[model samples]
Target: MTDEPLADLALSRSSLDRVALERRRSEVLSELLEDPRTRVAEIRGDRMQVVDPGDRAAPTAPGAPSAAKASGQDASRACSAGALGLVLRAPQPEDRERLVLHLGRDGDGTAYVGVVSPGPHEDPAQPGWLTLRQAGEALTRRDAGLFTTGLALANWHATHRFCPRCGAPTEPTEGGWVRRCEREGSDHYPRTDPAVIMSVVDPDDRLLLGRGAHWPEGRFSVLAGFVEPGESFEAAVAREVAEEVGITIDAARYLGNQPWPFPSSVMIGFAATTRQTELTVDPVEMAEARWVTRGEYRDLLREGTVRTPSGISIAKRIIEHWLGDTVESVTGGTSPRW
Candidate 1:
């Protein structure tokens, strides 16, 4: 396995420069829009349009096991032509008034655009609208960056149409990078909520996993919670672990982070050591909490008694890191029903 840096975590790398200054120029923006080499990732709701290469649009099965697979050739084979399938097309006629985001250039120097289409209807079959969760693992690194950036920007636009300062409707500017309020003259940028997710380990080398109140019975994952207004990531991790499972932890070691913008959140990963092995799971946040040896955890995964976040999620990445190797079923197959 290649030594992948934590920053290169799934949905992390991007070739885009985000050229904020250039986004302010109308002529420059118009030129990019007219460029035939520019590809537009049409984001509607939580899904973005990713051109399929031969295969039909396979929206990830809701309950399918996380699709975390190897990157490079493995990821390429998983999704046909992955990035090659993403063909740039001319903007549709009605897309004129919609938000347009600048995603920057690819390695080949082809510009990428992200078009935001907000409405009541989101048809997965209408074309390339694939959920980030469904298509994320198979996407090439550059494509991951493009798709995720687009989705994040689009999601922010959908929810923040009005200014929080003055309650006035905002107008899209800076190539859809910012929204300007007419009443307050304030510029609103995209918002990303920072959330900390951690793998809590005991002195016995056992890993802590928990089932959320709303999760399925057999599913369990590492403890995670959003960072409050005045809390740091480490503080949030400790507080969340304590509140959810009543476990006091030591220092939080930063692992990595992934952009999880189903509605906008950056999942920061950490490895936290806990002196308290006893679990007092909060019934409101989590249904149960337990510690398991690596072997037991592997067996539970193989037996279909437990499930973690998707392969593309940082949660699974942190878990695999703690296991000292990737955790796969003994059969080397994905459990779609889990």
Candidate 2:
């Protein structure tokens, strides 16, 4: 069905709750897992890369055959979604010479097998790890971004196996969805940190942007920061703009958001309209802040003006929306960006 995601082998995406995923026995899941005709795929970068779903030997990750002895192959592959989690989705080394296997923990506990290999475009793990492009494809090219969701959920669950309140251990349940603390009877749900992603626009329709102190050379993006506890989203927006640029936002227009699963965050997107256009730079937070006119921003985007945020990030979406916003709706009947 064309209902699949953008078919990105490497993009950050959320997961689809397989509502109809019949709860099968471990044997059935195993049997169906490697079936040749199982219309399935693997999540990478937030996108899905199709792999052959047939019961065949897939490719091997860095430590093949003996996944136990691969030097520095101990799980935490590179942290989580955004934290450098390094998970290898290598297939078997024998048989089907062309099939692919995912790097999954086997049932026997003594061996690690490729269990998630599905669809057709899956790589052979010839190099043992997915490349940056492949990672991006997996994150964005797929339908509904599953790779990021799966990996993020899995990573958080893996790291939080212990309870904080009681110092007791927890176990994975509900197909790795729920964590029930054994000692405290506490049920911990997945956590998604809240962040303010705003497009601070001046009356002249120029969008405000800044370069962070630690960003790469010539790299710049919209202002964004995490929202602290007990603070309203709008308050966070006003405070952030003031703190970062010395401007105050009078109104906030809610924009859509994207689930940034890089270790679990829900970016709250907004377009903050401010009449005051004074420049205030926080040496500790940003190197500089500037206002760009609609015409100027158009040129900037056309000529690669400043470093923009990732396409998958809400910051980018908010910017895109304002860039094309109707002149009248953009606060003062003025064009916003150049």
Candidate 3:
């Protein structure tokens, strides 16, 4: 197995400075909004505005040259040929009425904020608006971070408007990072559920793969499950493998992790080894489970028989770690998506 950590897990990349201390200042958001140097990323539903590097039709808001510079748009033409970038503009007056999130700052010290619309204000089928899954692999590192952080914050705020302890309405504070209950004044922060995704290998060097219940045929990826309360990640890995595939893993090694903000999750990855590989599958969680050697896996990809996980997923990176090469390198083409 490769000793090096998995490289370039999508959604894990970020160039932003997160200036977490700035979130504590009461005047920070006001000051940033007053200055046109602050760039605003608007989030509507699960989508954000994305634009091609060469597309000049989307004009920057007034006094936004600094905003554009901070967003790396000036140098984006030299980026990957078909790469997309976030559409950042000067803050609007209505942003104060919406859910405003103090995202972070770029290396240039220019701040970025996210304004969440109550609903999809624009047409969902519009060409420029895209969810993170659709545009993550194509966006620059900074934009990916902005979108992931913004979406996660937005989803949290949407679901957590009321305090659990007092059953009281909460108001956003701490630059939108914390919500305080109106009655009890208790603070609530964003929550990230931890899930373990693993590549389970048997003694013969075969990798275990399973298709989730109700997943389409030919769609398979490694086993994964939420980390139960009071359980370590390694323990969760072993338990999930056993519960899903009826196999007891002897040992599990840390691989890597990535922010998976599909409604809010951080996927912790692992590589597990097992001596027992009996074919007993759980019907509730998984439809099928099988072990495949590297050669067999490659052949399945070449024949388009098995669909891989999403390109922006830690599962894909974990699979590549076990395969010793990218799926594209094996298939010599774009991977068949699940």
Best by TM-score: 3
Off-target runs (Cα >4 Å) in candidate 3 are 60-82
Looking at candidate 3, what is the lDDT of residue 83? Answer: 78
Worst ten in a row by lDDT for model 3: 67-76
Question: Candidate 2, residues 1-338: lDDT per residue as tens digits?
Answer: 01122222124343333432332222333443454433233333323332211222333443334221111221112222332223323233332322222222222322122223323434434332333323432222222244454545644664688987898998654434557799878877768898988888878878887888877654656788899899999899889988998878889877656566667877777777888987879899998778887777656545544555543455655666667742224333222121
Ranking by lDDT: 3, 1, 2
Query: Residue 76 of model 2: what lDDT?
Result: 17
Better of 1 and 3 by TM-score: 3
Candidate 3 structure quality by residue, lDDT tens digits, 1-338: 69788877779888898888889998888888888888999899988878766762444553333212112222222223227778888877877788899989988888999989886455656556777877787678898899999999999999999999989999999899999999999999999999999999999999999999999999999999999999999999988988888889999889889999989999999899999989789999999999999999999999999999977888888898889988888887576785
Total colliding residue pairs, candidate 2: 55
Which model scores highest in lDDT?
Answer: 3
Q: Is candidate 2 or candidate 3 better by lDDT?
A: 3
Point out the higher-scoring one by TM-score: 2 or 3. Answer: 3
**How many residue pairs clash in each candidate at the backbone level?**
2, 55, 0
Cα deviation at 298, candidate 2, in Å, is 3.7
| RMSD, one per candidate, in order | 6.1, 11.2, 4.2
Single out the weakest 10-residue window by summed lDDT for candidate 1.
Answer: 62-71
Per-residue lDDT over 1-338 for candidate 1, one digit per residue giving the tens place of the 0 to 100 score: 12343645767866567677777886665787666556666666776545444542322332233223232333323522244233345555455667788887755767778877657655545444456676677676777888788888887887889999989999888887889998989999988899999988898989999988988887888888999998999999989998998889987888878888777899998888988888888999988888999889778878877776776688877878877666554426664222
